[model samples]
Target chain A: AQSVTQPDIHITVSEGASLELRCNYSYGATPYLFWYVQSPGQGLQLLLKYFSGDTLVQGIKGFEAEFKRSQSSFNLRKPSVHWSDAAEYFCGGDNQGGKLIFGQGTELSVKP
Target chain B: DVKVTQSSRYLVKRTGEKVFLECVQDMDHENMFWYRQDPGLGLRLIYFSYDVKMKEKGDIPEGYSVSREKKERFSLILESASTNQTSMYLCASSYPDSYQPQHFGDGTRLSIL
Candidate 1:
């Protein structure tokens, strides 16, 4: 079975601090990976995606994620955190077609 | 930019009532999907359509049905809504290629009374 896992249910970081959200995927082979952010009462917004090219993929809102083949991980990172960046983040993987399996999600809280 | 729109942002319906959630995508993508989201569960695929009039069941499709009469439009119907069925419904579209990322709608928060 293909699945995505985000170990942290929630994380708190002070504004200007660096952030990292861990994600692990289980699949038979390499899969398409993605990170999405959702604000309160709003829809999900794509943060970044990794298909096949570079290991490091850049996304919107100054976010990036690195795909590690050996670790089976696609961890999201941001050098500096902003208050507006506080939101629930989801990690997803697709091995076949366009169907995606998503993790439970990690809620990030940035304190000023 | 790709745009996926849902018919409602908030909906309130009674149990045993028929409910319809409409979604439209302007991207002309070949794949469209319906998902239901809940706390701690993230998102679960309900149904998906790869072409007009073609639909496939996702992880959870027991009480739900879908229609894709037109290429750009997909509808998710609840035959008999239940309290446990209340959730945030999301629609998404993407190219048929497996590598392409999906674009999402603002979502519809439906409540069963």
Candidate 2:
């Protein structure tokens, strides 16, 4: 079965620090990768997505993700983190059938 | 901006009662989906509708049903609500293309007592 994994359940980082959230997937072939963030009581917002071209895809909210086929990973990163960036992040992929398979989210905490 | 609106932000229902969660999208999206969010489980697709009157079962659709009688609305139905059914239910919509990103609603936090 296709699956997405986020190894870290919770991560804490100092404000202004660089951040990387790891994600790995198990799919038959290259699947469309995506990252979404959910704030305290809000719905999820799409961060970035990797469809085909350029392995490095930039998304809204100063976020970017790199898709590495070799490792089946599409990790989300940011050069500098802000307190407002503290949220639960989820990595997902499309099953090519309009259905999404999502990872067990990673809750990010930023400390000042 | 594409707006996907879920009917309720919070709800409480007793076990064994039927519950309905409504979702509406203004983008005229061809696909609408229902998912449940849990602490350690992230989000699990409950059901999805690709077109008016068309529905499909998702990974965890055993206890849920969906209705898409119109183009802009999709409804998730809990036949017999249970305590285990208490969850943050989210609704999303997207274009028919598989690559299109889904737009999510604020979600309805439902508690089954």
State the local distance difference test value for candidate 1. Answer: 0.95
- Candidate 1 lDDT tens digits, B17-109: 999999999989999999999988999999999999999999999999999999999999999999999999999999998889889999999
**Model 2 chain B worst lDDT run, 10 consecutive residues:** B56-65
Kindly give the stretch of ten consecutive residues in candidate 1 chain A with the minimal lDDT sum: A41-50
Query: Stretches of candidate 1 above 4 Å error?
Result: none
Give the TM-score comparing model 1 with the true structure, all chains together: 0.98
Give the per-residue lDDT of model 2 (tens digit) for A2-61.
Answer: 999999999999999999999999999899999999999999999989989999999998
User: What C-alpha lDDT do the candidate models reach, one value each?
Assistant: 0.95, 0.95
Cα-based lDDT at residue B111, candidate 1 = 98
Model 2 TM-score, all chains together: 0.98
Model 2: how many Å of interface RMSD? 0.8
- Candidate 1 lDDT over A2-103, as tens digits, reads 889999999999999999999999999999999999999888889999898899999999999999999999999999999999999999999888999999
